[model samples]
Target: MIYFFKLIRWKNLLLIILAQLLIKYALLEPLKVDYGLDTALTPLGFILLVIATISIAAAGYIINDIEDVEADTINKPDSVIIGKQISEKSATNLFIILNIIGVVSGFLISRAVDKSAFFVLFIITSGLLYLYSTYLKRITLIGNIVIAGLVSLSILLVGIFDLIPVISDSNKSSQLFFLSLIKDYAIFAFMINLLRELVKDIEDTDGDYKMNIQSMPILLGRSRATKLVFILSLIPLMIIVFYLSNNLYKQPMAIGYVLILIVAPMIYSTIKLFNATHKKDYKHISTVLKLIMLTGVLSLLLFQFILLK
Candidate 1:
């Protein structure tokens, strides 16, 4: 059981659950009455959505692990689970089972909202993750972008189901306004996850090279790739600054929260990235970036106070 949880990356799955919960309760629900908005999913339906999303995500992790078993053996042999704790056949079975649950649950929820078309999103996401693991991960940068985009989509999925389905003419603008808010956070998640993926690419260069994987670090060389990633890391800082100046400048509390929790840590990660040369250094930077992503999502809670004010 313990190994199964680790194989599915329960921690990351929990983060997905947390972000979706915040989107529903802390962000979207608060705006429903004031903006004359209606949500398509009830609380129970929303729980099903969370299950669908995380089930597919866990399946992704399992399949990725199965395909990367050789690379994992070279990279982190001690942490490898597919062959050590669970048989490859068992892992594959789990992958198929989870995907079935995810897509079926997605179908049920979409039909419940009378937007059966939304079911395609789950199928596409599942297929993309499978492609990413089997083939795309071998291509430089493509896999990183694909994974990052999916991370962003997880955040946007809530808005699509909850808000878009209920957009009447009277509430179209308000619906879009709140949907745009979710989109902004999704973009933030994209930028952070993209960088983190590249950092992991750098960290696992040795194993990737051994496996003939054409990752960014293997293609450009770790030093050059790290330099590129360091430059890219500046983007979120710039975006946050622009966001603050345009929107949050008047809200001192919001500004303080962004600076202290998100901005400061991002700067620290950037500086660390600049000097990061060893695998351990990249690992540390990756951990910092994960925290930044968490803080960025938690900022959604602040919207409750901001909206009320």
Candidate 2:
């Protein structure tokens, strides 16, 4: 059971669940958004949506591990599980089972919301995850962008399933407004995930190189790749600062929270990236980036206070 959790990357899976829950309860509900008030999915339906999402994500992790066993053996022998703990055959079975559940559940949710077309999102996500594990991940920047896009999609799925299906002519304007807000956060997730992916590529250059994977670090060399990642990190920091100044300046508590928790840590991570030479340094930077992502997600809780004032 422990090995199974590790294989599926349970920490990441939990983050996915938390992000969805926050979007549903913290952001949408408190705002009194009317889009899904009448025809929206029930609580049970929402749980199914979360399950479908994490199932696909878990399958992705499993397939990724299966494909990267050789690389993992070289990169972090201590963390390798495919061959040591769980047989490769069992891992593959789990992957297949998860993908089935994810797609089927997504189909059910789309029907529940009376937007069957939304089912394609799950299909595309599953396909991309499979391709990412097999081929795209070895290609320069494509893998990073694909994975980041999927992360953004997970965030946006809340808006689509909750708001779009219930949108009427009367509520269209307000519905879109909240959706645009969600999109902003999704873009933030994409940028942060992209930077983190690059950092991981640089950190895992040894294993990737041995596997003949043409990642950014292997192609451009670690020094140049690290510099590129550092430069890219500034994009999110600048965006967040601008958002705080323009949108949250009137709220001192929100501004302070954004600065101390999100912006400040991002700045620190960027600086750390500039000086990161050793794998451990890059690993530390990655951990910092993950924390920034968490803090950014948690910032949704601040919206209730903002809306009240």
TM-score of 2: 0.98
Give the distance in Å from residue 119's predicted Cα in candidate 1 to where it truly belongs. 0.6
**Which residue pairs clash in candidate 1?**
none
lDDT of 1 by residue, 1-309 (tens): 999999999988888888999999999888778878789999889988999999999999999999999999988899999888999999999999999999999999999899999999999999999999999989989999999999999999999999999999999998999999999999999999999999999999988998888999898999999999999999989999999999998899999999999999999999999999898999999999999988888999999789778
Candidate 1 whole-model C-alpha lDDT, 0 to 1: 0.94
lDDT of 1 at 52: 96
Give RMSD (Å) of candidate 1 vs. truth: 0.7
Model 2 lDDT tens row, 126-201 = 9999999999998999999999999999999999998899888877787887889899999999999999999999
RMSD of each: 0.7, 1.3
**Top TM-score prediction, candidate number:** 1
